[model samples]
Target: VGCFHQPSIVLADTDTLQSLPKREWNEGFAEIIKHAGIRDAAMFEEIEEVAQGVGDLPALIQRNVAIKARVVEADETETLGIRALLNFGHTLGHAIEAAAGYGGMLHGEAISLGLRAATWLSLQKSGLAAADGARLLRCLAAFELPLKLPADFDSNALLDIAAKDKKFEQGAIRFVLLRALGDAFVSCDITAEDMRAAILHLHEPV
Candidate 1:
């Protein structure tokens, strides 16, 4: 059923989000941020302007759902690789979750840190402008998301977990990297060394 079953209906209710704990609400925002960064520049700008306020929950949910719906419509089975672009911050994000024993950090918190690392890698490897990277960092910071690893975090363990990510294929890990604020692509060229550098950046003081 996981492979072939598709939902016949879906709902996006702003009221539901209002009931979530602050951390979980912020967790959902991480995915919203990722969606904008990977595919929708206009949405990214809107999110930057709005930050995480109580003024427009409906608009925020609509924007987020639209971006995801576009991707899913294009790659319902992930056969053409477009849907995988949704994993923009998940590679390192998942590693952070595992390293924390899955309870130390909320998924979005870890992904927020992963977004920083991925953006750094994008700057280094994908022609992402330094100014653009800084702008994204600032946007994330405005959400009060975690942007740095814990001082005592273990980079080596994170790497090991990242290596086991489900996206690994043919002996290489595939990473979704940004070329611009709203453009991203997956590449199998990311090396262990590249990952180490990004993870090290996480250890830096925010």
Candidate 2:
């Protein structure tokens, strides 16, 4: 499986979103926020504006697809770490999802918590301004996604799941941290304690 394949021409029909449950419909916005946070800061204003009500679905879908398309185009097989940037929130998010036993939590909800943790880590490790990080979280909140970790969350269990994740390579954790809004980079310096701190930080009142 050395080759990579993607549709030469892809189509997005925003009208189909009408069929999703209200909760299901909102799940995708977390990804849109992820795209804005990592690759297109300019989209934040539009996101905040549009999320309040469906301001423009087609444009938004196209933008999210375009961001992902560019990332894949740069590293079709993830041979380089550029594709890792797309996992900015996934590292921790997936752990929560797996710990919750998959159907236990909505994928978007778990990811919302992970994005919050990643943003907080960005503030601590990457010199991302507190305001900028808050803004990113605000975008997630705009979609009514869950920011706080579930009260019953098992950190050790989550960490164990994280340890087995594909994101971990060798002995280092290639966590994606943002130097600034729209500027995300993978870091190998994150320790288990730092991850614990972020998980605990989510329990604080926001």
Candidate 3:
């Protein structure tokens, strides 16, 4: 048996972000973009603005927290699948992290690639417009996140690992994909072959 609990309150001191290296500082932007992609489409413009210049960092962090809090509070234990929206790029991200042997590659870097894969999948499976997907890519590029699959990454190994993700249920992958900017949903329609194709597409050498 497992227990789930939400803390009485969640707090962050954005000032502490000053000490992180630029890599660490930028990592969470992936998740911020994910949150905006899935829930707050309007934030996408704000993100674009921030990319060109700094914005209200503290306010932006709180806005992200609020987006996540709403999703979590609605489906506390993931029983409703609502919280799975949070896994938008993590389906393949975790596999890539493991493929990297858990070192050298940062979690967010793996996720940026995973985000690319998911965005590609969305274009095919969910009617996501090329322009929408391009916007997402620009966000990743703006952060200088890796957009290519690491050359050493093995597709078969990545698939095998992804199959074991928590998002898989009854041997089906509930892959998260976007329908449009600011919209995402879990999909059981994705297949290993589809994932493989996306992996190869990423080998284009960005």
Candidate 4:
């Protein structure tokens, strides 16, 4: 199906989610967290409040759907910058997954690490406050998500892989960085050195 053919129906079955193992459930939360991080500070707080449990899966899923639906409705074809905000952690996330040979880490796990790296970058160049990044990290920690690069992870290799991300254009890669929780914007002026420093920062002990 082409971009014009939107899905006829979308469904969220909480019962199915309720049956997943804890690890799998947390994996799904990574995307949910990403959505909240980029679009709604209040939503992020709600998620953080329930970080240890999925007793409200139905409501949580609904909220996640609503956030994404709003973005999609506004930019169905991704021509508008609004839609690209959905890729908040995916550029670095995808590169990490590729460098890990795809199965070394779960997609969400890689993304969780990507989120931290992105936040660090945001603090440096996007005016994201240190306190905001700390708050986000605490939320991620509550879910036991990864916050650092894997052992023996190669920063140079990851950078090489990131350069191949689909978001790259005109010899620069576009990144979604948060100026504050729930406030994200795309910037293509990030230097390669800054990106490398962000990756390295993730490897440092918190």
Candidate 5:
């Protein structure tokens, strides 16, 4: 048997993935969210450390090790599961951003908003504790991730876009819910009306 080309691996010593293009920085960050087990304080501390000195390659790569582990452990079934988790906030998120067009919002930023909405739903459907939801909200805020939809976005178009996400099964969209930090599961029974209400409520002021 012959192996073709080099295996893609994220270097634990280097701050970057040698095989990955520089343009994929955000793509790398996308893996960060899945490691929900890491405390928010440590995660933000790493972010701050990176901001202070991007030249510290070792520390940056160390922070991303768990992400690499997940990817390395990925098989067909687990890969799909991870990908599905990544799509958590993507339903309404992608549509709002696409309709608003580029320069309006970054992809991760939009998805962050979606994550918040999904987490909100998780609280209702998956027994997510109030403290966990609050912590998630705070962590997203610390990362400067969005927690609300843009004011100009159209609700129906967003819903249509979300509906088209492949996570939908038998015509119902499935969502990943966090039962707690470090634990998440998926379900499709959440109604659109409730989802939309959650999104809308997140946008409203106290």
Candidate 6:
């Protein structure tokens, strides 16, 4: 149930919902791996197996829940942490969503691409290692997520939209970039050079 003024979740045709799995879940994994990372090779292997549909999702979720319970019990703080994760790939993804006129691409599609851009920038500017970045790219590719921005997209327009991102603080746009797998940081000091490079990388294939 939602808040008093909140609307109910919309139920779509089963076939339509099944067909749009990429749109629904790509953004989720984009956020999940941002915080979880491929730090443990075993975990990445599990993810790969799951991607191949040879692994069990319920078992994996149960395992993750057990792991999270150690760090945080059921509480508001835990809820906040979950929301924070939801925002992992949203920084740049929101800009792409706006620039593309909101519905041109799937929500997960935009976030998946945004995750790639942010991860690449993090490797250079935020100390996310190259190998870790490469691992993330591999996973995104495996999921069929777009790793680059469309050639016709204008970087300047994206930046302009980025400036309006709700995560901005005191007029400076803030970004969440991984410093390494399983660790991420928010920074407002990202440079114009990095921004330009990220957009260009998005336009060009890696």
Q: After superposition, how far is residue 168 of candidate 3 from its true place, in Å?
A: 3.5
Per-residue lDDT tens digits of candidate 5, residues 136-195? 666565555666665766777767776676666766677766777666656768777766
Q: Candidates ranked by TM-score, best first?
A: 2, 3, 4, 1, 6, 5
Quantify all predictions' global Cα lDDT against the true fold.
Answer: 0.84, 0.86, 0.85, 0.83, 0.60, 0.66
| Candidate 3: stretches off by over 4 Å | 1-5, 169-171
The total number of steric clashes, by the backbone 3 Å criterion, in model 4 comes to 0
- Residues 1-206, model 4: lDDT tens digits: 65465556678767876687787777777888898889988776678668855546678778888888889988998898999999888888888888889468888888988888888889988899999889888877788888888669999999888877777776667899999999999998876777788788878876
Task: List, residue by residue over 1-206, the lDDT tens digit for candidate 2.
Answer: 47677768878777888999989877888889898889999888879878877567678778888899999999887889899899989899988888889488898888888999999999999899999998998888788898887688787888888888765666667899899889999899887778888888877867
Worst 10 residues of 2 by lDDT: 164-173
- On TM-score, who's better, 1 or 5? 1
Winning model by TM-score: 2
- Which residues of candidate 5, in runs, are more than 4 Å off? 1-8, 12-31, 37-65, 68-72, 77-83
TM-scores, one per candidate: 0.91, 0.94, 0.93, 0.92, 0.70, 0.73
Q: What is the lDDT of residue 167 in candidate 1?
A: 70
Clash counts for all predictions: 0, 0, 0, 0, 1, 1
Query: What TM-score does prediction 6 earn?
Result: 0.73
How big is the RMSD of model 3? 1.8
The list of candidate 4 runs beyond 4 A from truth reads 1-9
> Residue 178 of candidate 6: its Cα lDDT?
76
- What would the per-residue lDDT of candidate 6 be over residues 20-96, giving only the tens digit for each residue? 55556555455445435522334666666767879765555544544344333333353444334435577788778
